[model samples]
Target: MYANTPRTTATRHRDRMSYDRDLVHSVLDEAWVCHLSFVVDGEPRVLPTLHVRIGDVLYVHGSTGSRPLRSAQPDGIKVSVAVTLLDGLVLARSQFHHSANYRSVVAHGTATVVTDPAEKSAVLTAIAEKIAVGRAADTRPPTPKELAQTSVLALPLVEVAAKMRTGGVSDDPEDYALPHWAGVLPLRVVAGDPEPDKGVEGVPDYLRAVIGVTG
Candidate 1:
C-alpha cells in the first residue's frame, strides 16, 4: 500500500482517488503511454512516451541526446508522470454533469538514469514484450552501438495515486426525465488485423494472442 502523501492526495473528487498499490500497478500496466513532465533550464516540458513497469520501478527510454534523458545525468531530476486509460464517455442529461470515465495514475519522483547494462537490457526487453508478447525473443537484441545511443530513465513508484471514474451518467434528479440520451458510451483500444511487410509471410501466434485474435 502507498501512503497518501500531500502531493498524491486529491484536492477534488477525493472519493475517486485510490492509494492501493495493486490499483496503481494495474493502471500503469494497462496504459502504454505516459506523459513525463520536468523542468529544463527553468522551463517546464512535457512529452508523451512509452513506459514499462518492472516491480515498483517505471522505466522510459529515448535517444541519449533528448532533453529529458540528458537532464537525468549524474544526479536525478525531479519529475511528474501521469498515465490514463479512458474507459467510457459519460453523457448526462444535462451538459454540466457530463464527464469521462477513466483510470489514471499520477506519480511524483526523481527520474534517474539507468546505467547498468543488465538492467537496461531487461528494461528494453520488458518494453518490447509490453508492446507484443514474444517480440523480444523474435527480434534481434539491441547491438552495443544501439545501446550506446539510447538512454533509459527509471522512476520509483513511491508517491503515486490512481484516480478513476466508472459506471453510467450522473445527472441531477430533476434532469433524469429530460428528453435526452444519457448513458455511458463504452470505449476501448482495439487492435486491428496485422499487416505484414512485403517480405513477411505469416503473423506470429504470440502477436495474434496479444491482440485477442483466436486461431
Candidate 2:
C-alpha cells in the first residue's frame, strides 16, 4: 500500500485525506476535466480545461495565443490542479447533515512547455486518444503550422493529494427518528449518441465504439 503524502502548511486537508501518488493518479485518469489554478500578476486564476495523464505527468494544452499558455514561460509555472468526481449525494434526516460523496485529487507542481516536435506530437496523440479511445489512429496528424500554433505543457505529478468521502449521510443520533427519508442520490457520466459532422460521409469505427452505437 502507498503511504499517504502528508499535507503541508500550504496544502488543504480535512478528515479522511489521502496523498498517495497511485490514488491521486487513479482519480485523475478517470476524469476528463481539471481546474488548473495558478498565480498570474499576483492574483490567482483557475482555468478549466481537458487534461490527460501519462504515467506521472499531466498534460494540458491550449493555443499558443491563449493567456495561460503565454504565461507559462521558460521561467516555469507553478500551478494547482483539481479533479473531482461526484459519486452521489448524501441526504440526511437533518438538512444540516447533507453532503456529497466524491473523489478528488489536488496536485501542485511546475509546468514546462513541451517544445520538441516529436514529443509534442506524441503528447497530442495521447490527448486525442484519451478523449475518444483509438481516435488518434483515424484522425489526421497535426500539420506543421498547426503544431507551431499549439502549446502543450507538461506538469510532473509532484506533491499531490486525493480525498474521498463515501457512504450515507451522518445525522445526529436523535435525528434518525425524525421520519425524514434519507439515502444516497447516485451520479454518473453517461455517454450520449455520437453525431457526425455535416460533411462527413461515414462514422468511424472508433467513434462508434466510443459511444457504443451502431450506425
**TM, every model:** 0.94, 0.87
Question: lDDT at 144 for candidate 2?
Answer: 83
Question: lDDT per residue, candidate 2, 1-215, as tens digits?
Answer: 23444541235336657767777888888888888888877988788887788888888764534586666788678888889998899999998989999989887778888777887788889888876788898889998887876687788877777889988889999998998999999987766776678887876767667564211
Cα deviation at 41, candidate 1, in Å, is: 3.2
Local distance difference test values of all predictions, in order = 0.85, 0.78
Worst 10 residues of 1 by lDDT: 206-215
Q: Give the top-scoring candidate (TM-score).
A: 1
CA RMSD per model (angstroms): 2.2, 3.3
How does residue 140 of candidate 1 score in lDDT?
88
Error of 2 at 178 (Å): 1.1
lDDT tens readout by residue for model 1, 41-118: 898888888889999999876553466567567689898999999999999999999999999999999989887777
